[model samples]
Target chain A: MELDFSIEGGDFTQAGQASSRVKKVLKQLGVDAKCIKSIVIALYEAEVNVVAHAYKGQIHIQIDKDKIQTLITDEGPGIPDIAMAMTEGFSTASKKVREMGFGAGMGLPNIKKNTDELKIDSVVGQSTTVSMVNYF
Target chain B: MKVSEIIDQLGLKVIAGEKGLDREISGAYVSDLLSDVMGNAREGQIWITLQVHQNVMAIASLKDLAAVILVKDLEANANTIQHSNEEQIPILSSSLSTFDIAGKLHALLADK
Candidate 1:
């Protein structure tokens, strides 16, 4: 099934809702446990990124028999340094995001870990597109 | 050990989904970072965290954690509880801090 979700950056409280819904759909579809874990982790980390860094974004999820692809796009402040952003402890969130127990700089790294193929394209002050693919 | 055993031992209060305590957890992972938990947590484990975010539910569900125990008496919003309910994920609250709860759970499960 091909699933698409629009994520609003209005409230931090609602940040992970889309990922949760995606998880439920994947579960009801009887996706493999390992594949489900991989997709959830990757998708959630990406979702966290959009909430933490971008002003707004959307998550596009496509699932088939052997693989899942997720494209998360954001129209917020892009990364100044993709290399630095990928570092485990580097974060750009304000005091508020930090207070929420996120913005600790683990989001991107976690997404990268869970997927088999990952790509990030960003330009400072433009936008970012993060693509992740997990093969079963 | 079963999650109920840990709860009883620590005197935890179930904020939601009390009936699922019969779940078993062989180990524990404590972290406020959902990413770290996702990267490190193993199956059949209990996650003790101070972070009361919806992502905690996502990470726990992905890992198939036996239960999630929020230490320091922190509270999550309705959305968190709602998502957890749909996923059938049990989230408990404890008056103890993360350190105390982790110690108690680790010691309780270790000897067995």
Candidate 2:
């Protein structure tokens, strides 16, 4: 199965919609509870990242018998230092974003911990793409 | 224990999603950070925080949380209450601070 979703920057109200839908689909497919939890967590963090930082983004998901794959691409101020951004407690979010209890710099780390494979590509002034996969 | 039991014991005011008052509560997590709650909170746990935005409801629904407790008498945004009602996950209120409410909730759950 395949799925796609669009994410709008600064739209905090709609941030987790994709994650919630994917979760329901995974549940109906009889995915293991642990696997579903990890997938949902990673996808949600990535979705929120787009809403928080990017100008706009798209998410593509592919589910096969053995694994689930996700690609999140965003157009915005891409990460200048992916390594630094992955570190805990590092963030560049504005004051307003921080006041809403986000931008704590745990987003990427959480995605990494929950996914079996993860890749991040960015063009500092243009766009970023995050690809992640988890085996069933 | 059920959500209604905690509401009765803690004197939490039900702000919305009264339909979920019978939902089961496995535990409680106290945090104002959205990502922290998302990364560490487990399913069936009641979230206690001061965040009043609709994003809080988004996280609560995605996490399959039992309910949300807004501490310090903070009122949720209009859209937040709307989402709570839509998802059927109760939005509860308490005048107590996060620290006080968390402590009380901890004691209450420990006895269960």
Candidate 3:
């Protein structure tokens, strides 16, 4: 099965709607409870990244018998250093995003911890694409 | 322990999602950072934090948390309350600071 969701940038109020829907779908499909938790956390952090930093983004989720894959693509001021961005405690979030209890620089690190296979690509001043996969 | 029991014992005020007062609490995770909770908190855990925002509800729901206890008497926003109601994850308030509430909550859950 496949699902796609559009995420609006700077919309903190609606940040996790996509992740919530995907979680329900995973539950209905009888995915393991532990796996569902991992996927939900990873996807949610990705969603928040888009909402907190991107102009806009798209999430594409695909579920197969063997694994679940998520691709998040965002148009924004792309990360100048994917290496630095992947480091925990490194974030460029604005004062407002930080005030909301986010931007602690743990987002990407959390994603990496949850997903089994991860890849991140970015171009300065253009866009970023993150793809993650978790085996069943 | 049930969420309501914690509220009663700790003198917490139910701010929203009254429907979930009976939800069972397995543990407590205290943090003010959204990513910390998102990355580490587990199902059935009661989150103790000072954050009072709509995104907090989103994390609580996605994490399948039993409840959210806001420390220092901080009040959740309208959107936070609305989401709490919709998700049936109770938002609770306490007059104590995070340090006090965390210690109390830890002792309570530990005794269980």
TM-score per prediction, in order, is 0.88, 0.98, 0.98
lDDT of 2 at A60: 97
Candidate 1 vs 2: which has more lDDT: 2
What lDDT score is found at residue B2 in candidate 1? 80
Candidates ranked by TM-score? 2, 3, 1
Give the clash count for each candidate.
0, 0, 0
Please give the CA lDDT of all the candidate structures: 0.80, 0.94, 0.94
lDDT of 1 by residue, A1-136 (tens): 7888777664565556666777788888888777777777778778777877788898888888877888889998898899999998998888877876778888888887788999999987979999888887
What fraction of the correct interface contacts does each predicted structure contain? 0.56, 0.94, 0.97
lDDT of 2 at A2: 100
In candidate 3, position B56 carries an lDDT of 93
Leading candidate by TM-score: 2
lDDT by residue (B1-112, candidate 3, tens digit) is: 8998988889999999999989999898988899999999988999998898899999999998999999888989999999999999999999999999999999988998
Of the true interface contacts, the fraction found in model 3 is 0.97
Which candidate's DockQ is highest?
3
Clashing pairs in 2: none
